[model samples]
Structures are given as structure tokens and as C-alpha cells.
Target: MPDHQQRIAYLLARYADKTCSREELDELFSAIGQGDGPEGLEQLLEEIWQARHPAPEIDYEAVYRQIKPAVPVRKTIPLKRIAIAASLLLLAGTAYWLLPSKRTGKQATVLIQPAQRRILPATNKAVLTLSDGTTVPLDSTGKQLIQQGNVAIRQQNGQLLYASQPTDGNIHYNKLTTPRGGQFRLVLPDGTKVWLNSASMLRYPTTFSGKERVVELDGQGYFEIAANAQQPFKVKVRDMEVLVLGTDFDVMAYGDENSVNTTLLTGSILVKEGSTKQLLQPGQQAVIDNQDHQLTVKTADIRKVTAWKNGMFVFNDMALPAILREVARWYDVDIVYKASPGAELYGGGIGRDLQLADVLALLEGNGFNHFGIEGRKVIVLP
Candidate 1:
């Protein structure tokens, strides 16, 4: 092998064995970005892949072409992000590159064949429960589900819409619950729009009848509240309350998470837990500790917080277990950890549309962990 090819091969070996230091990883990316000896490098990567998993046939030249054009030559890329990107290129039969642009950087994903299992991604699906204790299953089909008083409940284009007549004397409540591997969009009677993540539920009244338009959320939901200066919009999640007067925000109060995070994208919101209240401005986040109920404010990563709504999974130095927790919810699968995955953090963005096996392949390609699928369970192998 030539000197550059030998260096690249050596770096690949170290990367495969999980022994590459930060500088070495950067050097590896730099070497690849140099685009030296393309044919030799492609052959070398193919040989490595064939040696490990000989059953599959992959076009190394095509894969390399797909990757090389997308990888930005910037040296300022984070180590973990670059590592994950390169791992996807070599092991996952895909590549997710963070390409620099004039505005915010964008993610480019290239996928290949042999995604062994087809466990698909989440879609627009939920169950609606009426105040009269009746349940209605909702999907992407466009049709009127039922009528409650003067309000017409319909599911159209994967969204649940409540078209109401004039305020009747009677007020009823309805709940929309998204199962595992499911998500939904909702338009409340008061004109507020909500995007519910998987394994979440939202309960709201048929109309904004009282002094306040209050709704209850049990999991994650992004809200675009309609301006109602007289009757403020309030979101109740467990013991905490998000008070808003026409704003855009996201509330994540999942049971498995240790904190309730309320991120404000625009306007303002007052996050109150009991007597303690923290007012949040646009681009800020209020985090309430699940244990002690203490609240703290911090600058929010808007992209990461709203990635689900935007059809991406953006991780920034997130640990393996937490990442899998998200995976389990979206794929509607159980995760079994056979051995403890060490304190390795990952950073990148993957499309939420990919199948369970494809997502696992990208993660497992990082070389620190291996995954197996059995029935509806993803096993973390030692």
C-alpha cells in the first residue's frame, strides 16, 4: 500500500477497534477529505467490509462517490460527529454528513440496500377518547370521525381537526393519544396547533369555554398557540404548567425522562411548578427536575429540541442508553442491554423515516456497540 493508503488503512483498523484518540480521528477525516488514491481506498474499505460480513455485496466505488461529495473539508467538525459519519460510510453501508452551507449546516444522508429488518418508522396514528368514554382510532385517512355537540371532529391529512360552530352551552373534553411508533398533529377548537410525538397524549376541551384555554399533556408535544390575550393558553404536564399567550413552544415531560423540559421557540411562556415560576423568553428553555421540582433556565438548542417535528433525529453528545430509549419509542420496540455500553457520546442527525434496522446499523457502525433484533426487541450484544 502507498503511504497515504497505509495511513488510511491503519486509521480504519484503530477506528474499528475503538482505540482512536481525538487527534487520530481528526487525522483520519483529514486523510479521507484529502481524496488521495480513491481507487485504493475504496478497495481497502471493501476488503474490510467483506472480511467481516461476506454475505452481502456492496458497491464500494458508488458508496465512496456518494460520501466524498458530501463530506465538508472543514477541520472544525466535532470528533464524535466525524467518527459517526465515517463509521456510517464504512460499516453501515450509508453516510450521514453534516455539510456546511451559508446558513445553518445541513445533513445529507445516503442509504444502501440490505436493511435486514423492515421495522418501519412512526406515522400519523393515534386513538381519540371522547368525554362519553368512546374511543376512535385515527390514521391518515381523511374523514369525519364523530361529532360532539357543535364541534365537528375530523381526521384529514394525518391531522385531527376540530371545526366548531358557535359556543354551545355544553362543553366536552376529548383526548388524543399516540401509541408507540406513532405521531399526530392536532388543531384544537381554539385554533392552537399541536404536534404530538410518539407515546404521548393530549387532552383538551371541545372549545375554549372558561377563563383559560387549558390542555393536559403527558409526553412530548410542540405547540403553536393562537393569540388569546383575554383567555391565556395553558399546558399542564404533571405538576408543572406552561402559561402562554399566543406562542410557539415544545414541552417534553416523558415519564422515563428525569426532567420536564419546556423549550420556547417564539414569544414567551411562564413555566410554573407549584409556587416556583420561571419565565422563558424566545430561544430559552426551562428545565424542571423530576425529583425535587427545582426549575432552571438555559439557552435552548432549537434544532435538537424540534428535530422530531422536522423529520430528523439530531443528537448532540447523547449517551447510548438515552439514544436507545428514543429508538424504542419511535420504532415501538423493547431494548435489551446485554452488556453496559460505556460512557461514549454520539453526535449526528439521522432521518426518522429510516427503518429500525437501518437506524441500528448507523449506530452500531460506530464500532462501540453491536445490536441484534429478535421479534420486537433490540438487543445490545456484548
Candidate 2:
């Protein structure tokens, strides 16, 4: 091992023994940033494990046998504080080999990291606008239910549910809006589930008495529509309309993007923009140009598109500005770009639960190191 690796081993010993100083913790974390591949990390893990379990002089094969039999319980390991940083480096494409050698085909994971400055993850928060123009602040954990006529709307643990009561012929509309640093889930009166992303809005009726169940959407939302063939669900986004019956789909119609994307997950959906209409199958996406209103359908990666609803930020050939836009929305931060990474396509997946500084550090590890944060503003250096 090199001198730095030796030092890392020594620090790992101190860390495992819970005797490492604050300075030593920072040093170990910095050394972890310099780690090249899984070989070095594996050696460090072995050293740390041995330090924690000194009496058991077990070899690699013995350790593997001990873990391979039944379902091994997950225990907190040493360097828990810095593991998130290490994992971020690996996720940012710094060293793909930094992943464990044993898990070659497994998906990437996110770990919690300590940062000098932190911007916490977005939470389940939103505002409700009723048809009577009354505003209600929604809390994910609140049991407050708003009764309007035959509709009962209540929020429970990040999900807004609407239960039906005895209804008349009147139809009342309700709107749910998520702020920049928030997200929300809603169950419409028709039993359709919708996951609204940050900076999005959904306007739907409290009771669907009409022949067509229509809802208006702005920004991004994932929908799992109820199988009601009698009343097809239609989501209107800008000038486009997505018509579906008993299907799962995602609609992204943010104002910053030049196009509106409707990705079909399970059942089929018809995306209509202006006079042009396109039918999308499962794993297909319909891209409608915001300016020209031209609609084009293509195959898409459903996981990548729906990753936000799954608490992940999945970038597949995404541009830097676009990625930063997402970060800005989720973190509720302002961004200033000093130099543009024109047409640079980045591919990676990181948990959306991470703080802003950790995400930026991951980008720095991936060689985009010229960035500074002042207050809630991020300055991208040249």
C-alpha cells in the first residue's frame, strides 16, 4: 500500500475505535475522496472491520462465509459519517470501480454525507385552492379534513385523499400546488392517484359528474389512473392533452423546457397537441414542441422518467443547465452560471433526499468543481 493508503488505514483504526478527533475525521473523509477504486476501499474496509472486531482474526473467505449463509443483518459500520461522501463520488462517475467488487451488476445507492453547508431535501408540502377561492395549507402528517359538499379531502402522511359522500348534480373544482422545495401526492375523487413533483400544480374536480374526467396539470406529475372506461381520464397540459383510461403515465410540462413530455408506463395514452395526435405504448414517450405544437413519439426509459416519484434524480444524457434547474427547483435555490457546458450529457442516479451541498460535491468529484454557494444562490464558476 502507498503512504496515503497506510495513513487511511491508521485513521480507519482510530475511527472504528471511536477515538478519532474532529480533525482526524475530516482527514479521513478527505482521504476517502482521493480513493481511486474498490481495491483501496476494500482494503480500508477490511482494516476497519478488523479494528472493530479485533478478537476474530478472520480472513476474506471466512468473512464471506459468515455473511453468505442466511440473510445477513445490516449493522452500522465505521466511517458512517463519511460513507455518503464516498458513495456520492462513486455516483458522480468519479470511479465506477469504487463500488464493491462483489456487486458488479447491482444498482447504485446513495449514502448520507456531512457537508460544510447543507440544504435539506424537499418535503411533502403543498397548498390547496378550493373552488370557493379558499386557501388551505396542507401538512403531510395532519389529520385535518376539509369537507366540501359530498367530498371529503384529508391529508395523511404526505398523501391527500378524497373520499366520496352522497353527492348531488353540482361539481366543484380543487387545485393542489406544490412549491419549489416541495412535493405531494393526491388521490382524486375518482380513485386516481397522482404524484406531483416540485413546482407543479394539479386542478381537478371534487366530484366527476361529467362524461369525461378532465384535469389540468402544470409542471411534472405521475399519474396512476383508475380503470374507468366509461369516463376516460384526460390531463390537459398547456396546449397538449393526454387521454388515458386505466393507465400509468408521467407528464413533464415545465415552462423552462421547450417541449412537453408525456411518458406512458403501463397502459396506452393518446397525446394530442394542436391538431397532431400520437398514440403512445408502454415505454414510449410523446414529446410535444411548445412553440410549434408538433408532437413526436419515441421509446423512453420509464425508470429514468419516473425516478423523481421514486425519490431519485436520474440523469440520462441530461445537460448541465437542465440538471441544475432540477436542483434549483428541489432545493429552492437560485443558480448563476458563469460558463455553460454546452450539450454536455451527464448520466447518473442520486437520491433526491440528499442536501444541496452534497449533490454539488458529487458534481465536483465528477470534475465540475467550479461552483460556489452563497446563501441560497449557487454560482457556477468558469
Candidate 3:
């Protein structure tokens, strides 16, 4: 840190938290001169100053000091010169950006780490209106069941619940929906847990009517079915049927609008659409094209696909639409594309708790596109 860069770093640290006034910030940034400066010993005073003050005044010395990567010890060299040499190790943004992100990025991962805290995006959400017309709000608030007569309609954790008696055979249906950018979880009566993706829905009878435990799903859900060899678990989506004796799998059956992807995590299951039958083993994902009556099987990365249920936001070679789709759902926000930057595959990690602003900044910083908030909606400025 040549004294100036150290000062700049101090200022950025303070300004980042809104501790610095506007004038102080502008002057601090101006000193960086494209975020680089000649590096040399910052003097014992600069180190002493930083230690005395947890956050010192903005100076170039601090800026240079902070960005520098560490160097290993070698034969005979003083520590002070080593420090300055290390500061020069810090690269310009372009150098840092060279690391791949499936797309080009303007900044390095270190520069992008702090921007994770974001403003939540605007998206639609739906509440379950029970048969009695009582609405159950869905959010992070855990498992809750609303009783209605002989039926127990509640949400266990993120999964929907229907604790209906076997002999009662009362025919009632419950709807599960995720608006544009919201997701939910529910536990079915047969001990089948479902994780609903955003902007999707599921409708099912409160009681098992036939000899099978059946449910109709409209969006996406991950199911951990309770094994019942005698009474199999059947998932009816659009017009397709997925029968499982006992398995842990995920189904992306959003009607005929999108491809139905059934990924089996464990156990064997059979997928059926009309007259066609497709058997799936662990790690296999069956993509069903309802419009064409076609089903295709391929290897899948289940962690990236099923991370939503576990409160993780994962993207592995996912296109922009697919990545943003998950972000929109968890953050519960509407996405208005500012421009059309499509089909670019993205790979990285972010949290479900991130605000819309942070997520947008991440995308923009990482070379996807820029975004802004219009009132509550997230306007993706392509």
C-alpha cells in the first residue's frame, strides 16, 4: 500500500456501510485511478494507523493493502518489502475477471462477495384456501395444519398435509400454488413429502379414493414416498402417470407448458403417459413431452435440481431463464427483462435469503445482464 491506496480502502470500507459522507466517497474513489496505483512500503505509520483504528480514514494505502494476495516465505527478505511486493500482486479488474463464470464477469469473486445482501425481487404468491374458505398463508413459518371436520389439512414443514382416515373416503381436494417467484413444501397423508417450485401448483384429493395414493401435480415437486408395495404411490401430472412403490424423486410436471422432468434419487419407479411406460432407476431423469407424447431419459445432477427443498439455491450449467426462474420463486418477485439476454448457461451459488438487488448485482457483475427495481418488480435490463 502506497499510503494513498490504503486511504482509499479505508474510505470504501466506511462508505460501503454508509458511514462516509458523499464528498469523502467521491474523493476516495478518484484516488484509485482505475483501481490501481504504484505499490511500495506504506511506512510503519500506515500499519500502526490501521491497527489503532478498526476502520481508518480513506486512503490509497488501505486500498492496495486489502486487495493484495499473500506470498509465501523465501530465503532472506525483510517483511516490510514483502508487504509492498504483495500489494502489487493484486490485479486490475480485468485480470481478476479472467476467472470463468460460465460467462464473462466485470469483477473477481472477492469483489463480488459483499454484494450478496440484496433487495428481494417482486413476484406473485398464492395461499391455500381450504375447503372451508379459510386461507393459509405460506412463508418460512414452519409446519401448520388447519383442521376441517374429519379431515386434517395442514402443512408439515414445507409439504402439504391431508390426515384423512382411510375408511372415511371423503373426497376433498387441496390446491398448492407458487406465484411467479415463490416456492413451498408440503407433506402428503401417505408420508410423501413434496417440494413445490416457484410459479407451480399441485392439486390432490384429501383422502386416497382408490386402492392407490394418487395426487395431481401442476408445477414441480420432490417426493419422498413412503414405501407401500401393496398400495403404490402415483403422481398424475398433466396427463402422465408416475407410479412408485417407494422412492425419493423429483417431478417437474408443470402441465403441458414445460417438460416433465422426473428425477429419481433412490429406488425404481415407472413413468407412464397414456399408453407409454418408462422405467427409471436412481440418478435417471425422465423428461416427458406431453404435447408430442415423448419421454426421454438422461443422467442428472440431483443436488442442483433438488436444492430448493433444502433451502439452497444452486445453478449448474443452467440457462439464464432457468437460473432467474429459481431466483424469482424463492425471492418471490416478478421479473421484467430490461433486455433480451437469453440461453446463456450460468453456474454458481447464491442463497435463497438474498435480496433482489444483490441477486441482480451478482448477475450483472458476473456478465449475465443488469437489473433494476421498478417499484417492487425486478426489471432485468438486458
Candidate 1 lDDT over residue span 1-382, tens digit each: 6887688778777755555554675677776655333555555655655665474555545554444433445555433333334543445555442211111112222133345368899988999999999999998775666788778887889998898678878888899999999999999987899999999999999988878999999989999999989999999998999999989999999999989999999999999999999889899999999999999999998878988887777676778888888989999999888878746677656677778887876676553667788778888875
Q: Candidates' TM-scores?
A: 0.73, 0.72, 0.65
Q: Which candidate is the best by TM-score?
A: 1
Candidate with more favorable, higher TM-score: 1 or 3: 1
Give the distance in Å from residue 99's predicted Cα in candidate 2 to where it truly belongs.
12
Candidate 2 per-residue C-alpha lDDT over 187-269 given as tens digits, one digit per residue, 9 for 90 to 100: 98888999999999999989887689999999999999999999999999867889998999999999998889999989899
Candidate lDDT (C-alpha), each: 0.77, 0.71, 0.61
Candidate 2 ranges with C-alpha deviation above 4 Å? 1-116
How many clashing residue pairs appear in each of the predictions shown? 0, 0, 45
Sort the predicted structures by lDDT, highest score first: 1, 2, 3
Candidate 1: which stretches are off by over 4 Å? 1-116
* Global lDDT of model 2: 0.71
Superposed Cα deviation of residue 225, candidate 2 (Å): 0.6
> Per-residue lDDT for 1-382 in model 3, tens only?
4566567657645533334553564464344332233453244334544554444244444433332221223424444443333332222211011111345535422122234334454232457866555667776655676776677776544546666466464577777777766776667777677777777777776666578888778777888888888889898886788999998999876542457788999999999877888899899998877668788889987866676665455666666666666665566556677688655665534544445665565566656566666554666664
TM-score of 2: 0.72
lDDT at position 29, candidate 2: 57
- RMSD for each model, in Å, please? 9.1, 11.1, 12.8
